[model samples]
Target: MTTDEAREFARSYVRFLESMHELAGRGEGNEVVRRVQEHVGEEGRRHSVVGRGFAPFEQVNVQVALDRWSEQPERTVVVEGVTLPPHYGPVTLQQLLHGEALPPTRLTAPELVDLPSGPGRTTACVRNGLFLVDDEARGRFVLFARAPQPHQGEPVLQLELAGLPTDEAQKVLRELDELRTRHNVYRGQTVELAPEMHGGLSVVFPELPATERADVVLPDAVLARIERHAIGIADRREALRAAGRHLKRGLLLYGPPGTGKTHTTRYLVQHLAGATVLMLSGRSLQLVGAVTQLARELQPAAIVLEDVDLVAEDRGFGPGSSPVLFELLDAMDGAAADADLLFLLTTNRADLLEEALAARPGRVDVAVEIGLPDSDARRRLLDVYARGLRLEVSDATQDDAIERMAGVTASFVKELLRRAVLEALEGEAAPDGVVVKDEHLIRALDDLLDSAQGLTRALLGVRDGAAAPGGGPEPHPHTRQAYASSLSFVAEAGPGLQPWR
Candidate 1:
């Protein structure tokens, strides 16, 4: 059957069972059972008598509030539709919510034999059904009853661990440990997500995983700039306050693609204490209200609205466009009021962004640009990618390759290395089996340079000795001299291109 049909069947059956059980418990046992049996058996003579489907369950109204916990932090879990017996207290509620296993007082699945146990039988509700209590001390249980009450909210699944026999308990605990082991935060020193608690409402940390700074090779100047900004934030810790009530606090990062714009933000989120990262792409802006709600809920978070330019810009809708933008503005303003909150924005087209949105006092506080990687950065990129590979080329040849690929972006360099290294490691098994040769490196460089489209932008668009292969205008003598002299480097090393990496 389709999922909806199955769900309907379960709900109906559960409601009937719950109603009958409640009636039977209140001394109308025989009559309640008779009525139920007849309702199912006689509802239709043609219907199968033994195995008719269940009826929809009606939801119970049970509310659970976490009053206090002496050992663990107090947390509330409202049992949406079911009502708990009066015997339940704050401690019991705590035990129910955060308990690692089912409690001894609760019934197990197998012990349930009938709806309401006759004379001296113990019973409990579980998983939208009922179970019989076999032994109070041993807490062994079995399914004997199935009640149908409407499931109000999703039930919190709990298993009884403390109630298990000694040997069985140990085995269960071992299994639990095994299950938990897969969620290690550190995998051989390369930080990764803790599996079980990866991402959801409270899993923003894993959702915005920490970025490895050493993974990307950045130009010295750009790296230095990032460090200085981080240091400045740290140094101003004591004196820094939230942007005043009128001024919001946000950060803007804009630069060419593959220049580590996104990487830097992720790293910042991982490094900052008590900082949750809430990522919102341009498309999510369609439902601005939901996004705003998330922002309010996850305060003291790094709310990164990447490519805000796409949605926040004045889209010529006049007054209609203001609603969503205004909502976003209010949310950002509220975040600014919280001293611990930090908002980050990233966009490739910073020029397209609304000036007031990014430049206004109550919004973005700082804007930093990330650009291409330079010559030194290119060398680092190559080395980083070739760490486990045994290159057949001499240091001089490798250096020449770096020089040849000097003007390329960091991502392109990494891609080139990946392709070349993979070609070299085709049939090797050793840790350092790959041998990258000068010919491979030269081939990679040639492909990258030849395939690269026209340089729409550059730190300085003066490529003098590097002939214009695409029939572009040649540089004048003075411009050529300036271009050639603009760079400085050690002989046989790589040319140190200024500014743009």
Candidate 2:
């Protein structure tokens, strides 16, 4: 009885142990399967040796580069993380691998990135997903992320080349560089960089028609010099090089406001249609280095810096002057003489420009002063602006009227013609079609002569204290009354009351 009982208990114990072992084996197998899945996932591939190495902070640029590199959607691989910048909060590895949508807790503060040819203050989020960036270097690129995880120390980014050979990868990189250089991001575009963000610039392609050379009010001598130095040099690059002349040239167009400085620049831009043109002003001066680099890469390029006095302001003036002045000077000087780069800078306050910039040999080889248009030039400007309209006045009367507009700026003339057209349209005598009559111009001049428009006229390049053809500044009724009262007070007070006191 004892032996049988003992044997039954032993058998039961062995059965229990076998069941436990089977359960443990299943759990171990499940654990192994999970590990395998994690390893083969997108996140796992990001850390693999084949992945292109990049910093996590450079995810945007990397995405752009990769998107541009490969057109095939399947071959492109991306990984994202918030690890490199240090300020971004931690993102768990699990959240990344599972293709989980980043929760509000994981998102870093949104950043304002200046977009090319778009509205101001576009927001960029630091999260896990695919992102598109219009880069200055690359036209546009896609930042792709499958499952991105937070990392320690210096974060790394890797692009998986798939089965691409070393030679092919190199060829692709070369092609990418060439593509970036060949297709200009800022050609025929106006752009400004975001002062708040590093390396953030926005571009706007202006659909501006090419201004005719004859349309500009600049002197033919000034235009000729500019054409020869800037446009002509590019055209005769090989000849100039053979003649021991370098293609890199800097020309400064300085003049009072409302002159034809900018107009001349536009003509040059149009003249060099095949050349890359990069226009920068205001905040965009910060990107001078980048602009120069691109210009060098894309030879036969023109970089126009409007209101350059904002940067090249006299260092002695005071604090808050742009630090970019030195950078600009260096860029101009550093560029290779044979690069076929033209720097066309315009400024209303050229007198205030630093001597180092204005007088420097290579910085500004030619300083062309686009002064206020004289009588003949002013007449031409009027004629150009007044084109496509039937004038009520005869040629003789028009010439007389234009002569009377002497001392008025080119800007003033253009504005005057525009106002005249507007007046004609609004007038009861105005025909159904747009026809500008002599009375319309006279009325516009009368409006300009009003004391209220004195400041505006001055701003439009009219000389201060200059009288219009109709008359001097016409004081308002209230002002006339005040003047009369003051005169009376002065007379009544006599010597007893000092007006100064």
Candidate 3:
């Protein structure tokens, strides 16, 4: 509790006692005063050092008091929440009421008798500088420290080592004994903990598990960029070694849909051995509080947001499409301020991002384009898929259809080949598993063409041309470009900048 709160509680309790005293002075033998005295001086006390009273509540009573308390703000109390690791000790609840910080040093056989408090509830144990008190009945209770000893300007402990001695040891020991005197570690000197102490708040932050690593594949160029960035991080770290500072590196990947942007990010997580990564999708940012909370939770880890266009939508003029995007911008700046953190974003539409956000230099240090797979990449992509299918495509003639399928989108290539393989495995299983045929390829292609046609109409704003007399297909960019180019070549012979239409 704050100093003011302590003063208030003390004032209130004194007033209560004064009222009881006045009631007792009436000389009518009031039951209320009698009960007050019963608890105060008559309060059944097991032991007392000074005027303050101490009572150990039964387990049921303590639980009842804890239950009545509101569980809001989400972080109050210390029951199931503050989990102490087993390595601390096999301490009991009775020992905690006695109030002592647990000593971490393991005791040797010779030093067993030197243990303070004679191995009872008087001595305490703490882990990671956090002290957990074992209540007589309430089990483990984390004691809030009043104020931590100031860490700043503290003396550094110096170590002096010497081998166990014969004659030489005796001489060194005698000299050391004369120079320094041994002191006793006293226990049972009570230190009270207030509820609002900073020590208690320090224990509220949950511990995170170690990150697990996995192998992921990426394009060679993307992998090369990752290596260069890794080296840059190492160089920055070396430069800041004397100052003990960390460096931040951010990369933004922009590309069309069906590209391997997400895969590339996973590859980086695998490559950076000690790095922790939290992957969030753009849709999750739409929630009012999710963005800020996520930013805070993901600090000190690489925050990878996929499909950033969902967050940075086109709101037409200057007004934002979503308030969360502004909050996200603030979060990005906050994350960047920490020298050790990095933020990586992947998006399909670069134009959708705010101009101010996209133009930031250090915010997005390396803006790489994950373009569609080239012919050679397609060849490799097919080979990767073929290995998964366990099919031996040893004959060059047999793979003409597969070769034709490359150079498009990775998603399309993987999906089409997977469907063909599924079709080939309809009947009995063969030694080589069913060999995917040209017919299966044709069927997959037909399905892909239909899907592509729909996508094209949707994206290019093509309609049924219902307004036209014949109801023909609407004019499109590809047709317009082809027709205008053909006429331009004809016109170049004579007229210029005029179309045949």
Candidate 4:
């Protein structure tokens, strides 16, 4: 043969040998994995894979766990090609135990995600990574944390342990779970759990209004009752628990829509400083189970489910009748007697809530009615909303406004002051020093009471048939009839006398 041909043959033979060696060396700790698995398995030849899941709300929390767990001396590599399977999607580590084959994987730098750890705070967490953790306490094991992959059918943050004894896997996972709780981002913060389109929960940090005692315009007794149950009890929880008193309490606040049910809850939330406040309303109340479980992990927690009756059926609640309602009831009942947990439920339709609550008793220890504000409440609300405003109205005008505002809501009172300011701004009162006068206040009240704003009045929780309870104010004795209703009744009545449509 020619010298060039001989050289080419030698190079080809070297390439073949290199390929064989690489194939054989591809097994990284394969035997150790086998021993760990086979020891846990029937034959003790393969690795045993165990796993646990974290709710979508806990994405940041679990990331915190993995970050701390991997802080020790170890090697981490990103599990590449999760989308290489037949379905072309991400695969969880647990799939290994279910007979799924490990795809062609290359160890690469880990993929990490930066998430909000708190209000105006952020932290980095592993997205798709595996840890070859070898330690004296836990020994050698393969740990993986997989983020939710909707297309691949993984709907939650998943953690899996491979090649460890079954009992050992469980213990380590338990410790990790505890670590998650210890570093929970939602603990002692005011937040809402919002669901993603992919069926995972995302933590929402909402700035809850800071409400002081003076801001809550309910009757003194009513406000006192709320504080005693939600705040006062928590304050004395240690003493009460020492005396063997149960700290788990449920408070139900029912009233007409916009009559301060939610406002009252916010007041309670403000008082619950340093306690985790889970505020769920509307359709979000369906997440009672997840939120409640999280609350248990975060003690000194207050679960505020606003308008809870919205999720329950108007009829009886049997098995499968109202899963959301059932979950709510179960959550409240499941709390340990000594747990510092509070359930604050509010609903406009108390009648609808009565049945579901009756189905399972003792869930609510106290129920309070936050009805329409009385004359005194109206006066106080007017002054409260007008705090930062320049008021040029006389005492007589203020009394007239408050008396005319009977049967109205705290919301209505708040809007009244705002509308009065707008009225002043529109009528010769410059923006620089706009002073709300008696005329402006009267006109704004007239517009709100006009029949054209029927839905507006209802939305503000104003009862129909605008008549004050106890006959505080009679219809004006001298006034022109309204242009619309004049022909029907040409009697004397002022703008405030417009019959609530």
In terms of lDDT, which candidate is stronger, 1 or 2?
2
lDDT, candidate 2, 329-349, per-residue tens: 788888998888889888766
Clashes of each: 37, 6, 9, 6
Candidates ranked, most accurate by TM-score first: 4, 2, 1, 3
Q: Which residue runs of candidate 3 sit more than 4 Å off their true CA positions?
A: 1-219, 230-246, 286-300, 313-322, 336-338, 394-399, 437-443, 450-501
The prediction achieving the highest TM-score against the true structure is 4
Q: For model 1, where is the 10-residue window of minimal lDDT?
A: 58-67
Write model 4 residue lDDT over 1-501, tens digit each, in one string: 999999999999999988756543443323322333333354322556788877666878987876676664543322321222355566555543333344443444666677777888887776766665665665556677777765466766788887678898898898789889998988889887665675555667888777788988988888888789889999998899999998888888876666788888888888886899988876667667778889988988999998887777532235645467777888788878788989999876666666666667677767777777888998889889999888989999898777777667789889888899999999997658889888999888887776566667666666534544233232332111221222221112222111211
Q: Any idea what lDDT model 4 has?
A: 0.71
Candidate 4 pairs with clashing backbones? 37-46, 37-47, 37-48, 38-44, 38-45, 39-44
**Cα deviation in Å at residue 410, candidate 4?**
1.1
Q: Which regions of candidate 2 fall more than 4 Å away from where they truly are?
A: 1-65, 72-179, 182-200, 313-322, 429-432, 469-501
Backbone clashes in candidate 1 total 37
- lDDT by residue for model 1 (1-501), tens: 999999999999999999966654432433222222332233221222111111111001000001111112322212111223333321122122222122123222322212111123222323222222223233332111123221322212232222334464455334433332232211112111111211111111234444666765666566565554443453345455543232124666665555667777777666655443456665444333443443344434446666666665534224655634455555666553534445667866555554445333445555555655666787788877777767678789777776665444566666778767666566453574667777777665554444243442132232333323344323322232322321221111122111222
As for model 1, its CA RMSD to the true structure in angstroms is 17.3
Question: Over the stretch 330-381, how does candidate 3's per-residue lDDT look in tens digits?
Answer: 5665553435555667876655553545343335555666655655665666
Alpha-carbon TM-score of each model against the true structure: 0.48, 0.65, 0.45, 0.79
The top-ranked prediction according to lDDT is 4
